[model samples]
Target: MNNLKREFDASTVAMMRQAMNEVVADRRFLICQSVTPLEVAEHILEQAASGERDLDRLKISVFEKLSDAA
Candidate 1:
């Protein structure tokens, strides 16, 4: 999420924010606590950078990546 960052238009940013929030909520639900690991956000940002625009797909990809990492 460092140098990979690039400017996105307002709507894209909003979608990413919505996806991030949903991802966080889903993660919390899975573990039953208010915990959001930095890697989760980082991974989602990376996925967004990689041209993933769909909110649901972005979230599922994050969970899939996290599960693979675990």
Candidate 2:
């Protein structure tokens, strides 16, 4: 239903936002301004979709991605 779809969308957005905040607050990510927090957030969401929901793991995954980029 449309309502179910809307709810899913809302939850996804909330998750992404929370991930973004966590990434931004991380000391490892605080010094980097080249990549947008949104990009990192998307990466986190992708990892979560792939069944990795643990915050620490997500943070490490994002950190590694950014490290590789740099």
Candidate 3:
């Protein structure tokens, strides 16, 4: 599903929350000066927009984006 052009539904939202929670739980993700919850959420939405439906992948993508931003 190409969520890039559509509004995210409830399940997609739930997944993003779960993924964000997991990402923030990590100490490594917390110390990054450029990585904020809002930033992570935006990246999660970007991942979803790219058609990534897995929670793990969302978390991973957020991490990767953070790393790149660092």
Using TM-score, give the best candidate's number.
3
Off by over 4 Å in 3: 1-5
Tens-digit per-residue lDDT, 1-70, candidate 3: 2344568889988998899888988877977888788888778877788778899877878878878988
lDDT of 3: 0.81
How do the predictions measure up, each by TM-score? Answer: 0.74, 0.65, 0.79
lDDT of 1 by residue, 27-63 (tens): 4436733335677777777887888888889878877
By summed lDDT, which 10 consecutive residues of candidate 1 come out lowest?
27-36
Best by lDDT: 3
Clashing pairs in 3: none
Q: After superposition, how far is residue 65 of candidate 3 from its true place, in Å?
A: 1.3
Model 3: how far residue 10 lies from native, Å:
2.2
Q: Candidate 2 residues 1-70, lDDT tens each?
A: 1122222356656766676788888877877766677788668767766666566677788888778776
